[model samples]
Target: MIKRQAREEDETHTAVQGCLRDLGKSLGYDVWIAANDRNRPLDGGKLGDGCLGELPAAVGQAPGADAVRLIDVLWLAKETGRIVAAFEVEHTTSIYSGIVRMLDLALGPEAHALEGMFLVAPDGREGEVKAQLARPAFSRIADLKVHYLPYGELKANREAIARFGEGMKPIQAIARNLV
Candidate 1:
């Protein structure tokens, strides 16, 4: 039962990642899938197959490159390689890790310029997410304004947003500001 539940959770996370990938592309950003998650089939090919072979800027410039690499999804500016937004889908995994990854990106040299950072999880997890964010260790994340996007919300509007949305505004509208 535990194994089955874990598998289902992983599938949900993957589906969320795939939706983010599609939305990023539709909004004209080059999407990057985590190196480990690249193997998962999404759309017509592997998730990482559709992503850039390398980060526009080497993610390893900072000490958190390893953590940053596994960020569920990243929307980067195609020409400049600047990360426009970073997302971590916390389906059933540790929210602590997701927040930590956001911190890695937030503490990077270009932190101030990032357009957005988000934690995407199940709708019911909002209270858990809020409580976790309240922890002292996540102080920096709170300051950085990590947003929350529920799975149901993403799934509900992704198609319309993909087809008609002009830029990040549509996504932002759906994402709840965590802090």
Candidate 2:
């Protein structure tokens, strides 16, 4: 039972990541999947291979390059290669680690404001997410503005989005602002 549950969680997480990757691509952004997840297939190819061959110069040179590289997904502007948004899917992993990844990018050497930074998780995890965000360790960085995007919301709206959505506005609308 435990193994089955674990497999289910992994599948859910991969599905969400794939949806986000497709959305990012459709919206004219360069998409990147986590380095470790590069082997997972999406859009008829390895997710990482479909992404920017090289990260934007800023992210690559950041002090927390390693952390940034592991971010669940990154959507970069095609023309300038600047990160337009970052997302960390906390399907069943530690939320704290996800937030740390966001912090790595936010406070890194080439620090630049991202239009959106999100924690994508199952809907029931909202309370867990809020409680973790309120922890003392995150107190100083409370202004980071990490939003919460529930799995239910994404799964429910993904098809409509892929068919008719234009840009990041559709996603920003569905994601609840954590602050």
The lDDT of model 1 is: 0.85
lDDT of 2 by residue, 55-121 (tens): 8777787689889989899888888777778999999888988888889888775447478889999
- List the pairs of residues colliding in candidate 2: none
Instruction: Quickly count the clashes in candidate 1.
Output: 0
lDDT per residue, candidate 1, 117-175, as tens digits?
A: 99999999998898888888887776788899998889899989999997689989999
Model 1: how far residue 89 lies from native, Å = 0.5
Off by over 4 Å in 1: 58-60
User: Which runs in model 2 stand beyond 4 Å of their true positions?
Assistant: 42-45
CA lDDT scores, all candidates in order: 0.85, 0.83
The estimated TM-scores of all candidates read 0.93, 0.91
Best by TM-score: 1
